[model samples]
Target: MTPISQLSPRLLWQFFDTLCSIPHPSGHEAALRQWIADWAVERGLDVMQDAVGNLIIRKAASAGMEKRKGVILQAHMDMVPQANADTDHNFTTDPIQPYIDGDWVRARGTTLGADNGIGLSACMAVLADDKVQHGPLEVLLTIDEESGMTGAFGLAPGLLQGDILLNTDSEQDGDVYMGCAGGVDANITLPYEAEPVPAGHQALRLTITGLRGGHSGINIHQGRASANKLLAELLMDISQHAELRLSELDGGTLRNAIAREASALLTLPADAMDTLSALLERRQQQYRCEFAGIDDFIRLELAPATMPARVMSTSLQQRLSDALLACPHGVMEMSRSMDGVVQSSTNLGVIGTRPEHIHVQCLIRSLNDEGRNRVAEMTAAVFRLAGARCNFDGAYPGWQPDPDSAVMQLLLDTHKELFDVLPEVKVIHAGLECGLFKAVYPGWDMVSFGPTIQGAHSPDERVHIEAVSRFWQLLVRVLKQIPER
Candidate 1:
């Protein structure tokens, strides 16, 4: 069946359906990039690709609108690769199976790639439409935005020559995003040694599950229980109240997402098993009550295990547990200017103990370079206090909004002219390529807006089919209303 016939808002359904038939997961966007070029060439548009695989497709101004200003429409081509553990969808080569669920478009057991792919589709749809009125248009499709933003970061100077840029990457439809938080990935490591344990000690597995994990920046202040922190706290309590030897500890997957589940195998004295189980039950009840609103599914369970007797030394175990507890996670600071907005945050997303090293990964974000550095320093300080060696990489600046920007005024006017209602302008908590683009093209005015997308970076990701039409309508109005310089 044709995609347009399967969903509402014909243009959006057609665009989204075409996007799903391609595999554009982060770091695997070569095919999508080439496809975009082919699509542009088919329309007789001038398309070019940067060395780092950023596509810029140019279309002339609509008839009678040639005197209007030129505008750049930007969207990333990559999507976060995520799937339920039970899902067999392979992101490396398989196309996203976009299906309609009422007004939303979702994939089958995999991420829908609507986070930015929808934005890309919207831009492409506008480019192909011969009837849509607009100025000189340039569509920039960047690669590798989900994982590292390598395409934006690696953009060669002087490739784009637009004075105003519209980033179609925001998740909300009514909100106009002008600023985003800067971020850095901090990697921490600790030395550890595992040895055979006494024969009398028993093995037990401790598991924490059902936590409501989300985007660290968007949901950090919600107090959702982190699986890594929960497991670490329980182990610390056991390490203090009872004699416990750590055999293996592992939790979390991505370094950016809050851990939802964690498991630890350890050796404990047979005499202490009953007391430990009782303590765990009490703690679980206490935490359930604490996170009742944020994570109603929080669970902690203990069961016997048949693991080998090898274990980490008590000293090493103490150090690791202390570090995990001390390292700060979640919202660290609130925005001074924006009410209820997070200014800076850190996510203790992953923890694992290997044969020779205990590794921890944290994602830090802030609106300013100084604030980002502050959070990074705070995290490193905690690691240092716990005697762990810390390292950091992949640092990028934040996009600062200009309240009096000429393009912002044009957008405000255009939005009002089309809908008779003003769009809510604000900053977003997540990281975007706007920050990197600003660095490359200083003095360029930029704003981001998109259709409603939910559950990004997760399997439940979906996009509102109707919002795409609204988004397209607003974007076309903005382009047509651009004033001459």
Candidate 2:
């Protein structure tokens, strides 16, 4: 295997390559954590790994930079493990198949892991570079940032000696992220009765696949299609036109992602099959036209399903479909503070319809706790109206923006000096580890910046290759300009 340094450096590509070589999916980051520890120890640097598996590598102040204030460079080590069912790769133990595609680097049929991996790669690059002048640096790499941010939430307070912290986890290269939305995951359970298949009704599975899916928070306002929503729409329409009886319904995998594909098993009325097929054709075309520019590969298909021993009650099926249709799935409001910034949004992430009860999961995000709760309440209301039980989790707070931080000024000025342009400063609707970090390190001045990455949390995730150089330049510049104590 080619070393990571052959294609990229500051240890950037190399560390990313090594990281990809290991399977650091969410809670399963032990191997990667141990590998990172060994890497730090091999360089004779002081390293620490917390109980939660958040790793920190400390490099003593460099020469004259010793007297300067200490700084913390942070990034998450885990990636959202997403792959198509047809892909042979196993995220639990397989290396990412990364390749250069013109300006971007992407994985084969899986998420590129650039969301935080780029941030991780950037930190590794800085640490491996001896030429970059800077004060004492501590690289704080956390685990499980994708699912629950357990690593961030579990971080001990005052563990770092640094007063200035830089988070290299934001997506856009030309953006300095100051704040972000807080979020929570909610699950609703609806217990319903099911019966065995009725004779004389043909059993078929309606599958809808190939829709373009993306991050729920960042792309929610775009009005992209949701698999759960699409399946419900089709099934509801079928119910109107035919005496359809549902057996099973399933869609989506991650609660933080916009659902892309869905499948449903049902028995169609003998006479309405033709009408249903025609309606589906028309609906497909209509949806294609509606999202022609966004989702070019939307599909709807009906295929034979093996006979099942159970089927949902007619009332239950109707209630489930109605609940999904009534629930909100997109942007609720735009930022009043930042122009074009999404302030509040909801994602109807996953749905599973079994013979017993249906399970639905939704992730809600907002800069305000009240707004977040409001959206959650609105979501639960739908389930309640449909006679389904609802449950909510503790809400995570948003990172309150710090505009006057010294680090922000340094990064802003550094960008202007090198790139000849001002970086965009805004808050994102998506969750980040920074919020939890801030809760513990309240005194730390923080700002997040990174290379351009796209399609995170989805199989199409990729990082801009050339931007890596620019990102390296920015980090080196900021480090070199750190003020002396």
State which candidate has the highest lDDT.
2
Residue 153 CA displacement from its true place in model 2, Å:
1.0
- lDDT of each structure? 0.83, 0.85
List candidate 1 stretches off by more than 4 Å: 1-5, 270-273, 303-309
Q: Name model 2 segments beyond 4 Å from true.
A: 2-5, 8-10, 354-356
Q: Candidate 1, residues 1-485: lDDT per residue as tens digits?
A: 45543564466567767777888788888887887788789889999998988899999988987877778899998887767656788888888887778888788877888888777877887887788888788888888876778888899888876778999999887788889998999999888777778677899999887775766666677787899998989998887777788988998877767787789999888999889989998999999899888788787888999976578877778878888888889888899999988899989888887778888999999999888999899899988987889998988888998887888877777778877889888888888889999988986789988899877776777788788778888887788778765
For model 1, the run of ten residues with the poorest summed lDDT: 1-10
Candidate 2: tens digits of C-alpha lDDT, residues 1-485: 44334655436887787777888888888898888888889989899988788998998877888988888999998888888757887788898888878878889899988888878877877777787788989999998888888888889986789878888888887888889899998998999678767777888989988877889887788888998898888888888888889888899988998998889988875677789889999999988898889987899998887877778888888888898888998998888878998888999898986546788999999998888999998998889999989898746889989868888889999999999999988887889778878888888888888888888888988888778778888988898888876
Error of 2 at 191 (Å): 1.4
